[model samples]
Target: MALSSLDEVRERIGKAARLAGRRPDAVTLIAVSKTQPAPRILGLVSAGQRVFGENRVQEAEEKWPAIRERHPDIGLHLVGRLQSNKAEEAVRLFDAIHSVDRESLVTALARAMAKSGRRPDCFLQVNVGDEPQKGGCAVPDLPRLLEQARAADLPVAGLMCLPPADTEPAPFFALLAKLARRHDVAGLSMGMSADYESAVMIGATHVRVGTALFGQRGTEDG
Candidate 1:
């Protein structure tokens, strides 16, 4: 099957889980809705997706409020590089922030979280590939940043990493798993539409899948 709808994606989720020796519900599929129309998001929502992700804070600001008015209880995850200037908006919109990797952003998010009296969940984005273009904290520097976040009461529950595009993502995922364990954190958000099987094999607890579910997002969006 070509997998046109969210239901088909869920079935694929099941198959992927079984292949990984895990329960079908173990992996969370972040229906990436960045650049996708709101009606399409509603369609996926109707198709039984409670979790969705968006890349840019600005785009999310435009789309999420309208959608939330229609579905107030859905979980929204910010899966993009967030700037300190937009921290306030991100705090108000997302249930979780998965791309918090910098000291300034952590401080900003702390302020936002405190202001709302809400402890929003977060992930420490680790730059496992050491790519210059990426926005993640360097892996070697993650421990300090993670400690800083914890000290600031950022409610960090896990680590996230985007592996190099050219390499198999499994090794990087495995490394993040080890780093999380070393840091005593429980969540590892790695993997994507392409290498989720590799992610599962390496103990990824959450995978950010976009194209495999909702199809490829706009180049500028993801």
Candidate 2:
């Protein structure tokens, strides 16, 4: 029998889990669906994979809503940097937001969820690479930010980070796991196609994978 797409993903996920002494179900495989047409997503849903991640607010606004109507069971997660202006829409659409860093974004998401009568699960995006160009809370500032989120009754489920390019990711993932444990955070949503196994070893509960599973997302995108 041939390996279907979901089977391939399961195999990859299982391998990564086994290497880390974890069960396959311990990791939530966030199938990144950025720029793929809706039909492709629908096909994946038909195969019984339930969770999906998207990178852009506008793109989700355009694509997820219609698909949402048809497959209401599909869970949506915002896996990209989010602006304050887009926070409300993000809370409306996504089951979780994986990239929240600033106090302003937290305020926006909290307010939006307050009015909508629903709270979207969220994670603080940490800039583990300390790259000024990327979007994440600096490690030093994370405690204060996590405090603020809790003070505001925002159910911050965990922390998320992007490792800097050209480096091994173990240290960053280890630190993230430690932080998650210290705060009793529920998740560590790090790792992607290349470094996910390291993330699993370091206690990642959710891994956002795109290219290695979906065969590269969007033309000319890294």
RMSD of each: 1.9, 1.8
lDDT of each: 0.83, 0.85
Q: Write the per-residue lDDT of candidate 2 for residues 137-215, one digit (tens) a residue.
A: 9999999999889887887888999888879989989988888888789799988887877787778888887776568
Give the runs in model 2 whose Cα sits over 4 Å from its true position. Answer: 218-222
Writing each residue's lDDT as its tens digit, candidate 1 over 148-220 gives: 9998999897999889886877788988999999999988888877787678767777777777776765453
Q: Which residues of candidate 1, in runs, are more than 4 Å off? A: 1-4, 217-222
Please report the candidate that would top TM-score against the real structure: 2
TM of each candidate vs. truth: 0.93, 0.94
How much is the lDDT of residue 60 in candidate 1?
A: 90
Best by lDDT: 2
Model 2, C-alpha of 79: deviation from truth (Å): 0.5
What does the lDDT come to for candidate 2? 0.85
